[model samples]
Target chain A: MSTTRRVVIEPLTRVEGHGKVTIRLDSAGEVESARLHVVEFRGFERFIQGRPYWEMPVAVQRLCGICPVSHHLAAAKAMDGIVGVDELTPTAEKVRRLMHYGQIFQSHALHFFHLSSPDLLFGFDSDPATRNVIGVAGAFPELARQGILMRKYGQEVIQATAGKKVHGTGAIPGGVNRSLTSAERVELAADIPRQKRWAAEAVAIARDYTLENLAFATEFAAFPSNHLGLVRPDGTFDLYDGVLRAVDESGEKILNDVEAGRYADVLVEEVRPWSYMKFPFLRELGPHKGWYRVGPLARLAVCERIATPEAEAARVQFDEAMGGRPGTMSLAYHWARMIETLSAIEEIEQLLDDPDIEGDDLVRKGERRPESVGVIEAPRGTLFHHYVVADDDTVMRANLIVSTTSNNEPMNRAVESVAKKFLTGTEITEGLLNHVEVAIRAYDPCLSCATHALGKMPLVIEIQDAGGRTLAEGKRNS
Target chain B: MSESFTFYIDGVPVEAAPGMTILDAAQAAGIWIPRLCWHEELEPFGGCRVCTVKMNGRSCAACTQPAEPESVVENDSVALREWRKALVELLFAEGNHFCMACEKSGSCELQALAYRLGIAAPRFEHRWQAREVDASHADVLIDRNRCILCARCVRASRDLDGKNVFGFTGRGPERRVAVNSDARLRDTDLDVSDRAVDICPVGAIIRKGVGFTVPIGARRYDGAPIGSDVESANDELESANEHTEGGAAATVRQEE
Candidate 1:
């Protein structure tokens, strides 16, 4: 008789949020389907209801500790509309951009060095005991130290601009509250050369790892999907504020430069009963085919070029290496992430040199509007914050499309692709499951932000027969 | 004229008038006895009890207890510190402070007191009680979720502003600050310039459109502890006394 069984890997490791994967195998022990399940749920959208509209910028930071600045800026941008100012003062915009690049720099550095470096350095199928950040620290001490210091530098930049490292109140409706001081400028500028060098070295590390394992990198969970991010009006990489653009796998613009306020017109989110995270897709293509990949790889694919010189050069080389096509390789995310890090550091250097960041003309005023939408390219990917304020200035409703939610479909596809390629039998092993986790980690999914929940569960692999009886079980507590 | 008397606070001599409470005497002597509901501009309500101090072997509200002659007061004792810490923690647990996003964060007396007393987080479980916000007023917002029942606004509105715009309602956990009107704050005679708006020790009552204007580091309490100003005044007094003693000793040495 033909036998069908399911294998479940619960609570994936080395990622920001709590999630699991379940794969079903056919009679031939061939993978049939795999799904990534977000296990926690937090109703942040409902939490922000009835709060003052100005509080959104600070209150929404509670959504994700890892990327509170992203939420802060996104909500502030939206509130800028509620206050009816389409453009901010020069100083306000620059300070906010500085804060954002600092966030991107720190977030990307942390992911590459602390989270993903272990897999790249030690190999995916290595001993599960030492296959972590500790392992990376033991093997590549200097690289690990650089990662930590780089993260600290970025955090300092954040504190200097946002007033606090976590849950900053720097960005407010209409404008920012404070400008960068000249002393802060000098202090941050002093570290730019070192940061630039380290960022360049990080890019090299990711690039070398990808090229060294070219065969594995190209084939691992590789597939064509749509890409989405923000791009400057001049078609260059922009992480802070920009018009939204999305392209298909062939680099064709499916959704052109749509203003951030009009994002709801282009994208729609579909909810499934199985997971708390909603699947967001291009409105024109429907849910199935409209699903797209986000984050570093998607940003690189969607943007025409990086505006900074060093990063632009790196992007050129990256494109040349990809044969001038949008790279669908899941592992290539590390390379793109490093390139963006370099770009962020470069932008930070330029902003520090500019005098406008220290200007006192920080706030602006305009007429009021009841509804507004804010979109920005967060460290992970495109994040959207939409709010409808009552005439009394309280938030009537709020809808958030976090980066992880946008990449939900892509991450599921990645898990299935990896499982199909790696799964050999009904019994789940550590090495085989790590392969699945490695694919998901490439997306750098923040399930906490995606599900808007708290707490996490342990990792469990259950082998179930066709009748749903558990045949074998493996567990790893976290 | 009131009769002046002398008392001892933590063994330090403090002079006070007959009508002065222990808190008033401490402040006059440049000693800060932390009190939430004893603003200088308002009558002493003694509601918070954060200023509870042992006077003549009995604990009493320092803000209301009269400073008697020859009275020995025990302030800043370890037991008093812990009791005060618990009181602050309870106040924190009773309200949904949300200090992180509050406009009054750095300048807020409650938060500054918590920092001064080294209360990292409330030990008790948070009472996330549902509360109402009165944003109907054109220029004033009363977010009752942050109210600690200090009654500063009630006192200020009635005594100082002469508008009687705010009052207390309900009892126990249900008790909260209420507007004089049956409905929202807009219906009340409260104005933006009312001292009641500025007298709130927390974000419970605040002027609208003025939140988060001050940068983090420049705020009132960011540079020092909450009572540091009062403590600094004590430092200045001690230095002055030392200078006087030095001058007298110099004169004696010259005579010798």
Candidate 2:
């Protein structure tokens, strides 16, 4: 069977943004190769020229409403660096970290619990009518409720700390302007215990699930650690203020102290005329072959230790599943996220009780900067924000490298593996192609964030036989 | 417990009982809560909900709630808290808050809070209710859609100004803080200094054409706590009404 077939998914709708996927089959309509397409274009870098310094926060935060807090905080930190305000008053730093925690807690929960799990827990063909979390609620009500409750608690911290959740005015250039009282603190403090429980449950569930999928791990796995977030010596995650380190599957830190200023030297971005998204690869690995990843799962692999207890335990669970060392299995990435959620909760609780936060001396009134860069471990991956400003405080230029762009190479490998394994020499069938898309979905690629702003399937097939010689190749959208 | 303590608030201090209201102490100190529906001139009315505060225990309506033992109650806390978010959510859901489309965005307490709190979207669905805009008075225009039920207009109409020119016509989210005479503002016996204009929080009751004259950033409540702005707000309202059809707006001027 050497027939060629085509599966094309255009204007990938329903996700946060957009993308396209193309599948090619052989002569007998058997599969040949699979290519995932990312499409959408907006030149935020070229577009941010000639804006005011203080005004950049308002503008960059709009880049992603889902993680506005992180963007704003990172932007603030970069501006601080640019203006030489390295020492943030105790209260401002405390508030800044607390709000940053809010972003992590919410964004990760939305992904691991709400977005991706709908498929993993529910099973793809469990009747579309009852295939959502609402359906999951009908079946596993407690798990679903716990998921939502944890999300609510995380969002509540954001709301209580910032006066509102999505777009908060809590982060100012020099420092924060708002203060929290003891009563609000006590009220907020009460949510920690409940949050802790949900994180534990999530971790436990991830552990059990990973144990079930051994072949997917031991046989087919690919992750390059050459580029990812670095944890600090203090053990806490270094998202907003930290170093960038990339590792290979063999536990090697090839690059270290890759500061935001030098990101261009090590990282190279290229564009495909077919798709709008620009792919970023590790220079050492070079071009299409430079396989790298970012975000939570990539973070755990590169770091030496997790500062918090829950996260440490989750790391242990990962080691146990991988037999002493967790390699590059995408399935285990789900469990790793659970560990991250736990780490976020514990860190937030400790931050809320910081003594420095209780006193004054947060903001320094007027401390404008000339230029700066901000970076954070966005849930999908690592997000970077760079800004240049004139003496007039207006923005001169802006560039952003969304997290999903980094994982481009490895994600392609996954699709290539799945397509090759399932469709090596058979007639192209619908179910096989749908399975290809699922593998990519497993990465949870946020196309909406990837192109700097801007799939279908089918059935099973027959036995080995000399099949009809397929003519020209065509792509199908199901 | 009865010993008087000196406290400085916006440059004013007044002695109060161990359990007296900060709003009351401010009034005694001549600091004023600048509240709506609150009358030292009459019985306390909490419906205005504009006199909310941040006390030691929790945020509460200052008109109906008391002060803590040692801490001063601030209304900004109430205006920016969960209750305020919910209250604003309720207000937004109850009425249409289209700023660019409405005449009150710059002067609207609702819009000001949205900007202050960074509320980009109204959490709940807008009611989209079509309200009556009564222009019966030769000079006064009553737009029921803009009424936030702070009751400043209602209380000012009946108690202080004694014109009885306004009263709330309905209840709940549907309540209309309305004019009493059922006539346009200009057709009533109401004078320009009527407290109704003073008590109005949003631009529901302006003297007309003063909407764009003052820059939104420098308005009275910019730095003032939410409910606390009501008292001083009346004087501004009274002054605004006194200049009815007169020209005065700082950077800009209302219609002549």
Candidate 3:
């Protein structure tokens, strides 16, 4: 027996930005099939079609202030193809690659340590008032400070290149709008080794967390018949561009080198009646048999190696989680994120050391051309932007594949697995659902980018007692 | 693509770059086309429509029309007056174009454009759209009716800002900027430096801070509609010994 309960989330106040999560467990004491409902979509995909081709980098970068550099780079890649001006000065590309790495450092730190770490380490049920970084700050201020400095390093790289953070206006199609100074590169090089040590220590802390015995299936791997690669001979780690590959549990390649524009062929979105998000799968394998995951865990399995020394050491430990061949394990995603964080930092440093980055004429003014797709392996997953332009260089059409859309299926599957394991017969604790939500947040789905929206932050979860009296409820305003 | 053509502006004949917009050409020639909706950082949107100049016999928005041969653009002059006048009229009558009620009153683009054009009153009948002020956002607010369908804010959200936080819904005068996710901007991943606020031609879009700091004077489009009318109102400050033609010419300077 279930009674109707209307719980209104009044603008979830003071959180990340905008979002709420709502969960309804039937009277039968089971998730009547959970729904990850995203009530908001910013409509970025729809309106961006008519935008001037030249301004794509600055325009799309504003989609989310948090990861402006990534969006800026992706849009630049798409615009680069539209303009057909590929005299990409080595220094420009290097600075771009470096700025991108800085973004990875900051964003990964934010998502893993700040957003997802609290739930995993402190346990999600640890007092709402005490559940924040400040709550953790009293105990783990060093960790928090490390995350902030790492993020600042990335922001500084962007500032050095473009001018400021947020809407830095750094990456431009054909090349970057601004160039970096040799002095900036020197500073970046000096900072990387220090960051590398911090990442090393962070990885140590992450590796120590044993997520086993959490009641979830530690052995069940989703469509593990594919190894993934993002812009490399094999998926080792290529940030700017890559084709997504899926391998099976036994570690055999099912999908290899494929173009990103045709990514829709492999990722078929499944729209659950309950979720605003559509699940993605390997289309060639068929949905009935296709299940794949992207982002850090998926990336670790797809790539053959991590290019940086500090990260490679951590990769070995991360690789060990997948039985040495990059298998599918939900908890292993956290470990992979830390290792990639190290790789991302080292890669940025290497890019900074390049000498050709100081030239001012990096971008060709008023140059635009045909259709092209900018493909990159976002720290979350494979990201692709396909832009079709007119002969006059006006953008006619655009199709974007965001990290959230790629991970939607795996996220749901993981959530279901976790829910069935823990919440099947229990007190319907908030901590259990928080864990499940963190699993989805681990992918750091840019729903704002996926839907091409103005903004969206939907995390609506409702709770009530056995007699239908309100016990406690929490809403996601951020 | 149209064949390349040549055009003249301000007495100089120039070759029009193939497939170039008028704004692009003007920019290439080091000519500054004073604009609100057209930003280098954002996708070109002819929302404010203030950049309209006489090309052929007819006036067209500089941002929307292509730059081609056999076309002439007059940024300032009698021809520019008619366009600016009409442009001000539309901005005045549309939504709640109440210059007096706004804090961005004097410095408002619509008001400044009007003073430049010498609009005695909004000649057109006002079709005041019932609008609301959404103060939900921490930094900014959306004044619905004051907005002229110029998509500067939307462009800023998508192009320069990358927030994709605000957009236009419906079509024509029924058009309005809606926050993404249909929630107040406070609910979205948005900030005040949003280009939307930057491009608002009227008092419709104003930043939370710096409201009413400057006083407004003159009537509609005379001394100053944009907050501090220092540039346009300088003549009035020294009207006693000032050249009588000076005030009129200054208005003409802004008109073109």
Candidate 4:
């Protein structure tokens, strides 16, 4: 008689939202497949149907507390298109850009040092209780403090420009509602050098650690897949403003310079029965070949140049070290994250130095248009906020494609690859189960942003024998 | 007696003056009854039924009802709260209150009442009724879609500003706020300093060119809930009364 066994991992820890990893084994105890189930559902699109277009930027920020600024700016960008302005006033543009960079700086710092560092600084197999930011703080006090301060500085920058940090209503249609005062500008610029040095040190430490663990880093969910990101007209990395680009595993461009508003023309989303998040893919390639990786690693892979000097140097080393290929190793996300943080810090410094940043010409008036699509390279990846407005300026429809959801297919494949490689027998230890979480964490996928659910679920891992009887389980509340 | 009055609100005895209304006495005692269209600066206009409270087991508008001595008031009961919530839902349904997008969102009394009452969503189906926006005013916009027929603007215009520029027309669902001058606000004797512009409870009467002047998180009601000050006031008053004689018993009784 043949019997099938199912292993379920619930509420993946350190990540934003509740998610489960289910792996089924055949009667022969051979791996069948693995799936990441997003258990929460949020209907932001359905309820926001009758809202005003101008309010979308603020409303959409409610999607994720960790990355509200990304949604704020992306929604504003879409509203700008509706307002029929291609470019904002210089002061308005600089203010919004500063806010965006601040978000990127803080979000990257949060994920890298606070979230990912616990796993990397302390070995993955280390005691779960002591394997966290607290553990990192106990081991490397200065590193942990620097990480905290880095995020604090980023928040300060955000507060100065956008006004109350997270979910600030700074950016609006046509342009921003307020401008940076001279004092606010000085306050932001004052801390740049310290932040810059900290970013550089973080990149050095992350790169060195990644290089030292070359073997495991290369083997951890390392598979060739497509990479996607946004790039400036000159092919430089840009998080806030740019055109989308998609490249194959060999660093060959498949989709280049696609306008942000025209995302639907090139991409499509497919729903799956197992997860709440819909899998997005290239329109032409369909599901199989269409799956691609996003976020820092993908952004680094697609961009040819870094606009800032220090970040450019780090990118060069990163590309060469990662074999000059997109999707070389999933673990390289940490390294690329550090590089992006450096870029964000540099951009913040530059924006602060610009005199126009403190100018008072913040907003422009215009007639409302019928529809708009906004896109921005959020800290995670590309974020899209599309809205249709009636003649009265009330929102008729709202469609959002968050970064984590866009990476749904790639995340699932990565989980499976890690599970197949690591899960050898029936006995699933905490350390072994952590290997699976490490793969999901490598992507730094914000399941909260993806699912948009009301409440969070605890991360759980259950190993079941032949007839789906629980053999072992691992659970963590945090 | 000394011409003073005392009433039991939520079964706790509260002091009041003879002529003071229940709403006024409650305000002096730092007890909050969710209300709209009854601004302290303006005369009582019980157009909004949100402040309906159980007076001796009968429903009455708290803002207009005078405080009667020895009367039992049921202001904070589950059934009364639900009834109030239902009234708020009706208001929300009647008007186009897209709080997420409104300029007066954080400061809007209607939105704050909804938030304070924990009304996450309106229970009733929304009447997506089309309303005209009177942008004829060069400085002010009268978006009828967001108007809740609170009459605060009308009262402010007629009484406070003495312009008598705003009034209500029609009846029931068709009843709407209208400017006195048939032409436009610019043609009327209205300026940037009109009281009606600032008296709107919703986003209906907003000054143009200054939309979203306050950043969202920094806006009113962002840092604290709408009636948090009132709650604090109640605590302060209760503690102050405790410093006086016979306060501890009243405080304990109110808690119970």
Query: Top model by DockQ, which number?
Result: 1
Question: All predictions: root-mean-square deviation over Cα?
Answer: 6.0, 16.1, 16.0, 7.3
- For residues A1-478, what per-residue lDDT tens digits would candidate 4 score against the true structure? 4467778888788887779998887776667899999988888898767555666777878878888899889988988888788889999999999999999999899888888898888888889888889989999999999999999988878887777666667888889877777898887788889999999999998899889999987888888889888899778898888888999989888997898789999999999888999999999899899988889999998899998999999999998897877756878888999999999999999998999888888777666678888888998898888889776555788889999998788788888888788875656678877888888888888888887764444578877877768877767776
lDDT of candidate 2 over B1-256, digit per residue (tens) = 3676654333334466766667777665444443445666555777745456666546667666654445655543334345555666677777655454243544566665544444556688778887765544433445566666767776777778878887766666667765555445555677766666656767566653222223223445444434334344446433433332112222121110
State fnat for each of the candidate structures.
0.40, 0.00, 0.00, 0.45
The residue-level lDDT of candidate 4 at A388 comes to 90
Clashing pairs in 4: A8-A462, A9-A460, A9-A461, A10-A459, A10-A460, A11-A458, A11-A459, A11-A460, A12-A459
How high is the CA lDDT of each candidate model? 0.87, 0.61, 0.63, 0.82
- After superposition, the stretches of candidate 4 with alpha carbons farther than 4 Å from their true spots are A454-457, A465-472, B1-36, B39-43, B46-102, B110-149, B153-198, B204-211, B216-256
Which of the two, 2 or 3, has more lDDT? 3
The TM-score, computed over Cα atoms with residue i paired to residue i, of candidate 3 is 0.64
Interface DockQ of candidate 1: 0.48
- Better structure of 3 and 4 per lDDT: 4
Per-residue CA lDDT of model 1 for A148-220, tens digit only, reads 9999988988999888877778998989999988999999999999999999999999999888888987779
Query: What C-alpha lDDT, on a 0 to 100 scale, does residue B243 get in candidate 2?
Result: 30
Stretch of 10 with least lDDT, candidate 2 chain A: A455-464
Better of 2 and 4 by DockQ: 4
Worst 10 residues of 4 chain A by lDDT: A451-460
Q: Worst 10-residue stretch by lDDT in candidate 1 chain A?
A: A454-463
User: Candidate 4: TM-score?
Assistant: 0.78
Alpha-carbon deviation at A289 in model 2, angstroms: 4.1
